[model samples]
Target: MAREGRQWSDFEIAVSDYLTTLREKAGEPSYRRLAELTGIKFSRLRDIFTKQNGTPTLQEFIDLCLTFGKDPADVIYKIMKDLEAKGISLSNIPAQNDPADEANAALASADNGVDIDAWADRIKAEDSVHEEQP
Candidate 1:
């Protein structure tokens, strides 16, 4: 439950979507039955199914994957690799208490006044000077 509401991270959405597919393949078992098999409460399973928990806990994810006869590592690796192709990762999620500050910090990092273009130009000028010397 680290994240919730409209701010669901890509990782969370991916996990939820993956589990949904797994559930479907496993005959779409009832939450009650899943609870009995997984030892996770039916209510919690419902929340996970509805995505009300934002993202399932690592344990819950692993348990569900196992229950569905899927390998959690394989599923997670595939999902992470796909997300990585899009330049996204689970680490991108901000803290729960005050995410605005974290977002603002990311924005702030873009304007740190380190002018790379200027440095490149300077390096080019130095290279030309060295060429003239040799």
Candidate 2:
């Protein structure tokens, strides 16, 4: 049973939730197996899951995401959405660039044989249209 009046940090809750989902999706692999696959210590992973004084480093988080074949950005977006649904303000978090800026940067660096500037322009136009919707 959880303690009453215990306030969980956003990072703690988000990471716990994300780990639970991953475990469920993976059919609940053994902690040892997960540690081997993700290059994280089993003891550390166990501590984090049990909220026993373990916080994952960014590299560890990224490694776990890759092990689960998930995009880190998608995970971050989901966590942000969950926080918003709970009426939790994320003002303490550093501001990120608008999604449009990220899209444009990705397009500019993509080596997929498409014209970077043209793709960026198309993305900007699409974003403008989306903003005008509803």
Candidate 3:
């Protein structure tokens, strides 16, 4: 079961439902209040939970999960399992083939089997790149 198109995972659906429940419990306050509680910025919290632009950062996701009294790992695993059930591979995530992967490949190809120093340098470079991105 491998699907090509994007679809919400069971975890996503469940989280959405859980968010809705929390909203009701909190009397459906504005996203601003939700952000205040979840520690994500107002716009970012809205974007992930309401606007559906993209997934939230791990910290935001975990915070939101905790707000709903859900275990962060459990929720993440559920979402991943749900995605797999829908034919979506975890490898489909855009970061799967990031430059880190290339560096890992390079290390794997080292004549000495893997230059640790080179790998560390490559990882540092990638981290810098990540930091420089908006």
Return the top candidate by lDDT: 1
lDDT of 2 by residue, 18-120 (tens): 8778888989888899899988899877866666664666787788788888998888888887888888888878666799998978866876787767879
> What are the lDDT scores of the predictions, listed in order?
0.82, 0.79, 0.69
Give the per-residue lDDT of model 3 (tens digit) for 6-96.
4555455556665666667867778888777777788877666553656556677678778777797876666666677777666744433
- Structural RMSD, model 3: 13.4
Residue-by-residue lDDT tens digits, candidate 1, 82-112: 7878888557644235688877687668758
Clashing pairs in 3: none
Per-candidate RMSD, Å: 11.2, 14.3, 13.4
TM-score of 2: 0.63
The regions of model 3 sitting more than 4 angstroms off are 1-27, 51-54, 92-134
Number of clashing pairs per prediction, in order = 0, 0, 0
Q: Quick one: best TM-score, which candidate? A: 2
Instruction: Point out the higher-scoring one by TM-score: 2 or 3.
Output: 2
Q: Judged by lDDT against the true structure, how good is candidate 2?
A: 0.79
